[model samples]
Target: MNKPIYILGIESSCDDTAAAVIFNSKILSNVVASQKIHEEYGGVVPELASRAHQQNIVPVVASALKKACVSKEQLSAVAYTRGPGLMGALLVGSSFAKSLAMGLDLPLIEVNHMQAHILAHFIEDDSQTKPDFPFLALTISGGHTQIVKVTDYFNMEIIGQTIDDAVGEAFDKSAKILGFPYPGGPLIDKYAQLGNPNAFSFTKPKVGDLDFSFSGLKTAILYFVQNNTKTNPNFIKENIADICASIQFTIVDYLMDKLKNAVKETGIKEVAIGGGVSANSGIRKALKKAETDFGWKTHIPNFDYCTDNAAMIAIVGELKYKQNDFSDINVASKARMTF
Candidate 1:
């Protein structure tokens, strides 16, 4: 039998710095260090995020290697997120991976961050929900909203995308307007549980077929608050839950509407969702319900795997490595990496 290939993966395309070791397709260790510096600013500061990655990458990689008990010489290849993220953050990971690969004389794999997100479904230990080819995937995150058609490992196409703000960006911005702290998406989700989704009605923006536009929805919320507060200054405080529920419902509804249309247009049954926003409780529940309602199968990654991580990068890297897909040291990070 052939010895399984061991690969090291690095992911510093955003606020989190991560590293992981994988043997063949199985993950051995995954370590992520997140920067909390953005809390005071109510959003990620790109330069600060990059500086934090520079400081965290070395130690993070060391920890992953130690935990996996793997040596540099044993690594079959090194993989890193190549683009579609903060330029400085992507530079840190890409540069480190390139240097390490050069020093170790190993092949370097350039993994697209979004592609890694979709491939995250294959990283789970549970074998029952593996997605087959030509699958439909809805990838929602702070930076991107895309509906992808995965024909094969390397053959994926973006059939639909956001025209304005991403779904998660709407949640975060709404949370901020509601006086929540930075990284407000989770806060909104938490408070939403205590409120009624039907308490208020928010209009779903109509952009185009298979495309999304959250700008109108966001404006609607802003105007609603402005108008209501004119009558009662404490209107938001008095009806916080209902507001959250209403916003959450609108976002989920819009996502589902686009997803259903994509499935109908593509005529594919195997559907999956990934990226940071995929971890949203409302989105998860709605996707599951859609599966039953539309008679389609759904695949979602575990909570840990749903967010930015190196394991997903390693999984994508492994797939590429097997096909002898490698990148040169001169490969640069891209700010808008597309499928």
Candidate 2:
């Protein structure tokens, strides 16, 4: 029992094939193989993504083990994302992790992809501060947008969630309308800093105070671009920065508003954010500003953990492993799962 617990984590929830090794609470190494093929199609193609995972997962896991200076035999268990993603993509990770665990006679842990994003904060790291219990977690990503109430390592409640398109989709779709390439969320964030946020305004959808809806916002943006370009063919080119800034501004503002409401309802002053969108510069700056303006504490994981990476899965695996939580040999992946 005194020996360190090592977990080999695998994540293939989407286009990224990730693997990581965690020693106790600290990450020893994390590696991700991103599928650039998705960029050509403007979004991930599930079949292609699964095939890429098949090709990349082995090398990625090997690299993680090598970098961590640990052999597969040293690992106490294998953890992998099991659901709420493309079925084919989820299968690649599940099948590999199951096989590895069985081969080693080790425990196999099934992790919720979304839950991993929230637990990522607990990964022992010098660069980040862990959130306290009962804090609010704003999870923003391409496929999900939810406010989770984390009361413990495993006890989490989704107090609020999107009714339609997730925040990341809103960002990417808006950027696409601007003629930006696939995975345009980051591009939107980059250009946002160069222009005024108020240069263009998009109305936030009228969803319930806790629930979010971004489909309408995407439609609004599409029309705005279409109408504008009719008058000036070079409209987007001339005002790309301002347009991006404005879209980013509205999305961040809407997210903040929901977080504020959650805090009010739960009386939880401590806030944490996770998921890919958490890396957006505007949201990070806004969280920093909230610490001063609202006297609230905030936590944001390091950039690497903010995205869909295996380190998060490893950390969650470590937590569940502590509780003796293990899945059976019959465990299967789910295309749609809930925390």
Please list the C-alpha lDDT of all candidates, in the order they appear. 0.91, 0.94
* Candidate 1 lDDT by residue in tens digits, 29-145: 999999999999999999999999999999999999999999878899999999989999999999999999999899999999999999988875664267998899999999999
Kindly give the stretch of ten consecutive residues in candidate 2 with the minimal lDDT sum. Answer: 1-10
lDDT of 2 by residue, 1-339 (tens): 587799999999999999999986899999999999989899999999999999999999999999999999899999999988999999999999998998999999999999999999999999899998879999999999999998988888999999989999999998888888999999999999999999989999998989999999999999999999999999999999999989889999999999999988989999999999999999999998999988889998999999999999999999999999999979889989887
Best by lDDT: 2
Candidate of highest TM-score = 2
Query: Residue 229 in model 1: shift from native, Å?
Result: 2.3
**All candidates: CA RMSD (Å):** 1.2, 0.8
Q: After superposing candidate 2, which stretches have Cα over 4 Å from the reference? A: none
Q: Where does candidate 1 have its weakest 10-residue lDDT segment? A: 121-130
Backbone collisions counted per model: 0, 0
